[model samples]
Target: MIGKTFSHYKILEKLGEGGMGVVYLAEDSKLERKVAIKFLPRHFATHSDEWERFKIEAKAAAALNHPNIATIHAIEEVNDEIFIVMEYIDGQELKEKISKGPITIEESIKIAIQITEGLNAAHEKDIVHRDIKSSNIMITEKGKVKIMDFGLAKIRGGVQLTKEQSALGTAAYMSPEQARGEPTDHGADIWAFG
Candidate 1:
């Protein structure tokens, strides 16, 4: 990936790569602050569906200003790349922590509690997080839990999934309803918790 400035943000360091794109821990020169920038991979850059969903993710994520949600500052298109500028959290991804090992039952429950609260808020607005897992949960330095990747989120009356009996969610975290490709509602999240 290129390490060029997007508007006022100066790419500081490559954070980590994901299936969709490369993430960078950047510095917002204008604001003199830090932010995380996620770039849309070139292959998907021209996909209208992904682009549209990215917009929806921006709107959905920006809607919730809660402490448990990653704060989205702006979503922009620089040249041929799409990037989302989010609050730069100085902490490890929950999955990274889990990778070092599993958490205690009590700690796991606490983390789940915070996530459930955020999910409930989004669900109340009819937003479904199609992808939810330990990897997408960000733990801030101050012990705050923030959910990420509302990118795959489905909104009410939103786009339809393809019909090949295909599943479009994180395999491990997917609820049975989602896994089975059945119609689902808020209950799906509860099932995911199981």
Candidate 2:
């Protein structure tokens, strides 16, 4: 999809790819700004359940507005392809930072505070971020934190997405209850954060 225009976004180059979708750096023609476009893989897009979950991820995250959280500008479909337009963050993933070397206590505390605030915002909205790990958190050039990937989030009072005894998320970060395949709440995020 490189060099192609979807809606008003002109794809410049691919930024990265993950299990959920491929993200691209694009230019917004109408707004004259840069943005990231995450497109659902064609193979997975054909699956109704997965497609619905992708849409849900957009909806869940779009409802939240916080400086510590990545902003979802739009969820669009072009030629039957679904994609999400999000704020382009210029920084490294927290995972990379942690892997490079040990972070100072002060830096760690700063990051922890940002993460907690971000999580607090989500939890206050009754949205549980089931997947909370270093890889899903970004540290911007200005040292600001932005929590991303709401694909595995569970909206409180919404339909139960996972079956009973079905565990989801990175095994290493999974809470005891999550690892045990039990229902989890916001507390699961706390476990992962620790």
Candidate 3:
């Protein structure tokens, strides 16, 4: 999609891809700012269930306004191509940092605190980010932590999105209850933090 114009945004380069969507770096000509746009994979876009989940992810994240959580600018569909425009985070994923080597205790503590703060904000809004693994966490170049991807988030007392008895998050980081496919709340996030 490089060089293609989706609305007023011109795609510059591909950022990354995951199970849920493919992210791209784009230039928002209207706002004159760099933004990251996540598009539902072509295959998934045709599936109503996946489309609903993608919309939910946008709604869940767009509702938050926190420094430690990536900001959602807008969710748009152009000619049936659905995508979400969000703040472009120029940094590496926490998973990449950890893969290089172990970080100092102090650095670890700082990251943990930021993640906790972000999670706190989400919980306060009754949003449970089911996927809280390292890859889902971005550490900006300036040492700011921003949580990304609320694809599996469950908004408490909201519509039921997932199938019963089916696990939704990363296996290694899931809380016992989450792994068991049981009902969860903010406690699941706290458990992942540990």
Candidate 4:
């Protein structure tokens, strides 16, 4: 369904592909707006757990209303494939922009503040952001920071999170306790904010 049109979203360009899924730039005909559509992996299509996680991600992310978090617009199944629609930012991802040079400390602090506010909002609602990283942070042309990819993050009572020596979050950013396989709370997100 990469080149296919689901409802009014005409697939325009392929933006990204990763272990989780593929992202495409799509046009929202009804609103005359552009949106990002993430398609789940084909292999995981019938996998109950992955499907549950994907649905959970769509529902959970859609519930978050903050200036610093990406807005989830809709989730629908087309031809047995799950796709999530989100605000299609027209600027560079933080990873792409960061390479030009490090952002100023003040700018960096502002980014942290934005993330903290977003995380705090989620945490206040008991939605912990387990995977907060530079790559997951998007920097729009207007200088706003929007966090992405809570696909791996889970609600407290949702799932076991992971299975093995490794933890849920990226190794470079995981809290010590989280890496040690301990249950993490909202403060764990603050610890990762650094």
Cα-based lDDT at residue 171, candidate 4: 78
Where model 4 places Cα greater than 4 Å from the true spot, the runs are 159-166
Number of the candidate with higher TM-score, 1 or 2 = 2
Candidate 1 clashes between residue pairs 3 or more apart in a chain or in different chains: none
Give the distance in Å from residue 46's predicted Cα in candidate 1 to where it truly belongs.
Answer: 1.8
lDDT comparison, 1 vs 2, better candidate: 2
Expressed as tens digits, the lDDT of each residue in 1-194 for candidate 2 is 89999889999999888768999999999999999899999987888777887888888899999999999999999988889999999899999998999999999999999999999999999888899999899999889999988878788888676767888888999999989988888999999999
Residue 147 in model 1: lDDT: 85
Q: Who wins the TM-score comparison? A: 3
TM-score list, all predictions: 0.87, 0.94, 0.95, 0.90
* Alpha carbon deviation, residue 70, candidate 2 (Å): 0.3
Model 2: residue 77 alpha-carbon error in angstroms: 0.5
Which 10 residues in a row give candidate 1 its minimum summed lDDT? 156-165
lDDT of 3 at 149: 90
Q: What is the lDDT of residue 178 in candidate 2?
A: 89
How do the candidates rank by TM-score, highest first?
Answer: 3, 2, 4, 1
Comparing candidate 3 with candidate 4, which one achieves the higher lDDT?
Answer: 3
State the lDDT of candidate 4 residue by residue for 11-46, as single tens digits. 999988755679899989999999999999987787
- What TM-score would candidate 2 get against the native? 0.94
**Worst ten-residue run, lDDT, model 3?**
159-168
Which candidate do you rate higher for TM-score, 2 or 4? 2
